[model samples]
Target chain A: MDSELPPLLVLGPPAVFNIFKSQYPHKYRFLNAFSSDLPLLQFLQTQNTHPSSVRAIFCNQRQLVTADIIRSLPSLGIIATSTVGYDHIDTTECRRRGIQIATLGSQFAADVADMAVALLIDVIFKISAGDRFVKKLVPFKPWSFPSDSKLGGKRIGIIGLGRIGAEVAKRLEAFDCIIMYHSRNKNPSVSYTFYSNVLDLASDSDVLVLCCPLTEQTKYIVNKEVMLALGKDGIIVNIGRGALVDENELVQCLMKGEIRGAGLDVFENEPYVPKELFSLDNVVLSPHAAALTLDCFMDSCRHVAKSLDAFFSS
Target chain B: MDSELPPLLVLGPPAVFNIFKSQYPHKYRFLNAFSSDLPLLQFLQTQNTHPSSVRAIFCNQRQLVTADIIRSLPSLGIIATSTVGYDHIDTTECRRRGIQIATLGSQFAADVADMAVALLIDVIFKISAGDRFVKKLVPFKPWSFPSDSKLGGKRIGIIGLGRIGAEVAKRLEAFDCIIMYHSRNKNPSVSYTFYSNVLDLASDSDVLVLCCPLTEQTKYIVNKEVMLALGKDGIIVNIGRGALVDENELVQCLMKGEIRGAGLDVFENEPYVPKELFSLDNVVLSPHAAALTLDCFMDSCRHVAKSLDAFFSS
Candidate 1:
């Protein structure tokens, strides 16, 4: 019965495998790379079955599905990623091999947008700082602690009004924020003030939210000039990816108070944040877990399973 | 020339005076009590001018306008407070003496509501915990760190559907939250589900947010019973007043894990928080600073000045 089932290649960390295993339909048998004692390529080479039998690859955000992984599997027809961002996957390699890519498609947009606003408010209100002050023996001086500005009526510039960016714009609207966007093309459906140039957007905005994808054209988009344009009273919130901004420049800007503060969930290096940001009360840092909610994970799992099932059965 | 200007009595800490003094219209001469070496009552007694000369008192959130103070001023025509809640002022004494009372009238509603949503997201997503973990030497594990649920589609029961509560509802709606409320009366302006009974609201809600004013009837509204009904998966957010929930019961619930977590901006005691909560990761504490923003404070100063001017002119 197990032999009759289609073979699915499971890529990424063990955590993704655990979640995918629970939600995935039993129609496909998973060749779990994470569970193998040997390296992924060696484990595949040792598999008694033919490499062409692996019809699909299930990948998550944590692991990169490199070109080598794509070239190794001859029958890999579809790569289903359980996240909105596909920068971790070798998309150019997959395109060259004529592989269909299935993304979670804004399923986790609300979660990510919620975090963007969360970090924005935390920075503006010095919420985490206040929490630390209260927890610490330091006196709770309201006037001194949160002398920052309010969230309402501030001009907010959003990069890439895609699914996550659109969700962020919608949420900030409720706060009475003046929303503007710098996307590849101005969205005709919405009436938000459009800025074709990101530098212009940063210059006009009190806050800049990065929700765009990480691509060749977009890597290090928020460089020194953009940060300087944002001014000392401005803030930056990156929920998109770490490489979206020049991380070193960000740290320098924050340290010098050139840009007021930052609320970064993504860093240039994952799991490794700059030590300078640790002591700065103005900057709030999170370990890239914005879309790691149980609900989002479950949704992602089901979406990947459904997409793979559809591709195979068709 | 100074006597030509109407005398306006200023009360509260020196911080309030600093802000009040900046925006105050020159028409009124401030009898600044906060800067005086003598106590408030002693300061009043030491004044060379007759008590009848003082026509209006400007008080901020930090000070309490007691019955004794009201009795001391024979010509007090109006008391203007630079906050939404007037519980600090002796309302009963003002009513007896036919003295009018003026409040900021939801000027800080957006700021407070923004903080409410900020606290909610921080508690749910473990943004602060994630920051702490990253800042510390702990390994960044996505699945392990944020094992909590998402903010979207949660049944949030707002305790008061007033100005602040209304703003919270509007913001949460963008996150796709199902907002319910248990206010003194059902608000006709909103379409959210209304529960007249507090117990029913708590039982049905995954999260309970206290945004109502602290009053005689509303004091300790969330007691042990309410917490139990909210259950172990529940979260409490107090951006209103601290006394809205029984602080002892809340502390017990949090300790025992009777409820999941809390995001508190207000406490029963100002500047002093419970020592037990310092080590807990579930509770996020702030120093009663929901409305402590530069924009909100300036708006409040302007509002107080306008109201006082209008009252005297009328």
Candidate 2:
């Protein structure tokens, strides 16, 4: 390690640490926590330098920067997370301590929007279901299977018309989808119809794409009533947080065909998705990987490095 | 049946016959072949009316209109098919006999284009594969799976820049993909780059989308050499006829990792896909349902009925 290099504590999924270390050459001396078998507190205590030397902590959603973790890092000036969502970090504590926060921000918008559209298209066209049917060697009769819905001219309701939602709208527009949205306030920049309430948006739309962050007011935003309003022909695509939808209601609706289908990238319980969803052909499930594309991940890695460099220099 | 009503022969999948009969009402007297237990010729002979009275045939890809079938209907004037591809009919024989042929034409282009983009996104983002992995209840880890490729900034070469190809290019452009083409002639209407030779196009593209019609000159157009040119990271999306690609070569290339993946909606033989494709996560297979969306199917049915009505009126 270069003596002149600034030291930063790196805590996240081992994969992120490895990628940053390998792909991003050393601008900072990364004190990788995974390199120590000891617990995080003990690892920090055992470091040759004082805890105050580490001015910034590089992390992601995999590791939470709880109040305890923040307290232990005596001189931590900023919590730089390589994810758009910072719900995992102790922002309240950071606010009290006057420690700033830096996030990947809109850097992940395009890749996540691509995933939202991809999932929506997959559901409407029955691509995943058709793939299973073909691979299972089911006897194919001409026009035997129920016909799929076309993407063109369908009204798509975007729950959050933020960066990702705007990108989703832009892509789906080429498919001729009617774009509608529900957000905190009416956006003056775009011409898409805005509904203040999500229920009204669901009733008038064919598909609902969740792209909002998980906040107190937005948690369980898509409940049973909202789903019913979307009707039996509706589809739900969640590229946002898992808790944005009530997973139980979603599973029940999918099971009973209350809603036509769903393409879920995030689940309430995460890796512990309802086993009932396993057999449903109308539903397409993905692990939480909306922003995991190589391009997005590398971009985020670069953003994190830049944020750290700026914070330490200031 | 009304004596003034024009008698017409309907031979195709039973679904088409049922839908047309139920939806089309009393426009004409349908001499449905499936209604009789006897062979088609015998069924016509057993009918009290003369075979020459049935002057038009309404069929689809499910039924072949061969020279023998045409010979039996001495007064046959037109063969109207409810599909974009007219290769199923004996066009050469129709030309010799001075009989007219009508197809759905560009009506199915939008639906087919939608499927092409859906398949492309599904393959590139690993949507189907991710769905399978999540459904299979595999242990999920952050950044565990290989990072997926992004759609933006990718060079996509369209094999046939006709109506369907043009529609596909329009949709993909919204995702920020660079569009190139290989067609019979340079299409001057659009500004997309055109390549007269497909090999050069393959070399320049990261993805190849097949949208051309299948004919003697175009059969086996994407062979081993083209696949090799596409390289290991390249993907092939076939929404056109299956015979356009050498299935054996494609299967081998996919198996050897010579090419990244494939999204096939058509095959050399109908309903008989290669068994090797069953276990591959890199491939998404649809049972020839590209133009089978409910909206598209109903539209084509209406078009077929109009074609038949026009022929009978003349």
Q: Write the per-residue lDDT of candidate 1 for residues B212-309, one digit (tens) a residue.
A: 99999999999999999999999999999889999999999999999999999988876668989887778898877787766667777778778887
Q: Which segments of candidate 1 are over 4 A away from where they belong?
A: A1-8, A22-32, A35-39, A45-53, A137-148, A311-314, B1-8, B23-41, B45-53, B137-143, B311-314
* lDDT value, residue A158 of candidate 1: 98
Write one digit per residue (lDDT tens) for candidate 2, span A18-68.
667777666777788856788776787776656778788888776778999
Candidate 2 error regions (>4 Å): A1-7, A24-39, A46-53, A137-148, B2-7, B25-40, B46-51, B137-148
Top-TM-score structure, candidate number = 2
lDDT of 2 by residue, B175-248 (tens): 99999999999988999999999999999999999999988889999999999999999999999999999999
DockQ of each: 0.64, 0.63
Clashing pairs for predicted structure model 2, backbone only: none
Prediction 1 TM-score vs. true: 0.91
Assess the local accuracy of residue A102 in candidate 2 as a C-alpha lDDT between 0 and 100: 91
